[model samples]
Target: MTQYDVTLEWPDDGTDTVAVSPTETVLEVALREGIRLPYDCREGTCITCVGRVLAAGGDETPGAEEAVDAADAFDYRRQPKALTEDERANGYVLLCIAVPRADCRVAVGPMVRSEVGDSPWS
Candidate 1:
């Protein structure tokens, strides 16, 4: 199994340093760590787990799929603002669907939580 180092940032001053496996989804790890990042479908179809790649200072390894271009980002399961090709190339991984191929540093931005309206379920 490939061991990857990952860093996650949350709005509530929460952070995590975890060892990730090549087969483990980012969403799985984040949930295990109790991060408040939003998630819907655990598949790539949802963009709720999408986030920015803060740093990728390692080997250029082939990711799960070709880097998603801004246009393709929209065609996914859940519609989200398209991320620039550069962003996707530089290691932006959609947490729900992305599994690490190398050690990575990623930051989930604050806007995701801001958009969550008062939940009728809650």
Candidate 2:
């Protein structure tokens, strides 16, 4: 089985890197590894597991002409119901419904989604 490293950056604090397989959601691996991540519904319908895939480790400021969204790092099992297309294109992912496809870093915690406007579940 192939695995990828998913670096989870928690709010105001910690970071953990866990191995993830394309066959399972990141949350599943996180739960199995005993990694503490805030989650409620284990579905794409909620933003509880929302994470922003950072660009360039978020170390330096990105130039206005150099925006990079690493959306290809993970695949959405279902059409992401909680995120707008813009958010998806901008590297936002719902870890509960995402399967890693490549090594990626994610920003997690309360601050990440305090104002996320999700698509209405119809």
Per-residue lDDT of 120 in model 2:
72
Per-model TM-score on C-alpha atoms = 0.59, 0.83
The local distance difference test score of each candidate is 0.54, 0.78
TM-score of 2: 0.83
Give the per-residue lDDT digits (tens) of candidate 1, residues 1-122.
Answer: 55677777665656676776766766777778776667775655445566655445453343434442323211233422333345455444467766665565565765643433322222
Candidate 2 Cα lDDT to native: 0.78
- At residue 40, what lDDT does model 2 achieve? 72
When summed lDDT is taken over every stretch of 10 residues in candidate 2, the lowest stretch is 56-65
Backbone clash pairs for candidate 2 read none
**Candidate 1 weakest lDDT stretch, 10 residues:** 68-77
